[model samples]
Target chain A: SQTIHQWPATLVQPVGSPLSLECTVEGTSNPNLYWYRQAAGRGLQLLFYSVGIGQISSEVPQNLSASRPQDRQFILSSKKLLLSDSGFYLCAWSRGNTNTEAFFGQGTRLTVV
Target chain B: AQTVTQSQPEMSVQEAETVTLSCTYDTSESDYYLFWYKQPPSRQMILVIRQEAYKQQNATENRFSVNFQKAAKSFSLKISDSQLGDAAMYFCALGETSGSRLTFGEGTQLTVNP
Candidate 1:
C-alpha cells in the first residue's frame, strides 16, 4: 500500500512568509513526485515535478521552488510569500515509467495574512 | 503545448438522474491518456476514470463512465444515478504517452440536487 504524507493540513502565515512544505511517500521507491496549487474554487496548477533525487522540473516560475532530497521525499519552499500565494497545495506521486496514474495526498491549505 | 477545455463551468443534476460533463483537448500527440478527477469540498482529489487513446472501448466504474472520441479530441464523463456523494468539482486532464505530466482544464463544478 502506497501512502503520501503532507504536514500542517492548514497553515496561516504573514505576507512575507518563508514557507517550507514537505511531502513524503511510503511503500514506494523512486516514484515521481509533484507539487500543485489550487486557488479558491479554481482549478489546479502544476508547480513542480521531480523524476529523481535532485531532479526538479518547474512548470510555473514564481516565488516558489521545489527540491527532491530523497527518492520519495519532495519539499516546496519559498523565501517570501505574497497574498496571492495563499491557496491549497497538493502533493502527488506516480510510477516514474509510463504509468501515469497519480496518487495525491490530503493537501495543505495555506492562508497568507 | 497541450491544453484541455471544459465548456461548462458548473452543472446540476437531480438524484437518480444522469448528467454529462463535456471536455475537449488540443494535442498533436497521437499517444496520450485522458482522466477525470473529482474534488470535494474537502479538496482531496481522486481519480474518477481514465481512458487510453489507443483503446476504442469506453471505460466505466460503476455509475461513472467516459465517452472518448479520439479523432475529435473529446472526452466526456457521464454519471448515472447521481448521488449526493457525487457532488464535486470535476477536472479533465491529459497526459502524454511519453511523459506523465498532466495538463488539466479549468474544471466543472457539479451539484447533485435531491
Candidate 2:
C-alpha cells in the first residue's frame, strides 16, 4: 500500500519567519508529486508540481516555493512567511503518466500569527 | 486551462435519504478524468469516485455513483441512503490526460442530519 506523510500536522509561525513543510511517499517510486493550498472557506489552489527530482512547475506566483530533493521527498519552503501565507497545505501523489486518482496526505494547517 | 464548478456551497440530507451534489466542468481536452473527493473535519482527502471521459457508462461504487455527462461537460455525484458519517466537504476535481495535476472546484459542504 502507498502512503504519504506530512508534518508537523499543525503549525503556528510568526510573520516573516522562515517556513518548511515536508512530504514524503512510501511504497511508490518516481510518482508525480503536487502541492496545493486551501484558504479558509475557499477552494484549493495549486502551488507546485514535480514529475521528477529537480523538475518543478509552478501554477501560481506567490510567496512560496517547492523542491523535490528525492524521488519521494518534496519540500515547500518560504524565506519569509507572510500573514497571507497561512492556510491548509496538502501534499498529493499520483502514478506517473497514468490518469489515476491522487492520494493525499493528512495536510498541514499553518496559522501565521 | 480546465476549471470545475460546484454551484452549491452547502447541502444537507437526512440520514438514509439520497442526495445528489452537482459539479460542472469546462475543458478543452477531449480525454480527461473527473473525480469526487471527500474531506472530513480531519481534512484528509479521500477519493470517492472517478469517471473517465472516454467511458460512456456511468461509474458506481456500492452506495456512491457518478452521473457523467461528457457531452454536457457535467459530472455529478449521487449518494444513496446517506449516512451521518457521509457529512464532509465534497470536492470535484478535473485531471488532464497527461495526468500531471488536478484542478479543483469550490467544495460543497455536505451536512448529514441525524
Q: Per-candidate DockQ versus the true complex?
A: 0.70, 0.83
Question: TM-score per candidate, in order?
Answer: 0.98, 0.98
Q: Which candidate tops DockQ? A: 2
Chain B TM-scores per candidate, in order, are 0.98, 0.98
True-contact fraction in model 1 equals 0.48
DockQ, computed on Cα atoms, for candidate 1: 0.70
Query: Would you give me the overall lDDT of model 1?
Result: 0.93
* Local accuracy of candidate 2 as per-residue lDDT tens digits, B1-114: 889999999999999999999999999998999999999988989999999999999999999999998888999999999999999999999999865889999999999999
The CAPRI class of candidate 1 is: medium
Query: What lDDT is obtained when candidate 2 is compared to the true structure?
Result: 0.95
Candidate 1 regions with alpha-carbon error over 4 angstroms: none
What TM-score would candidate 2 get against the native? 0.98
Best by lDDT: 2
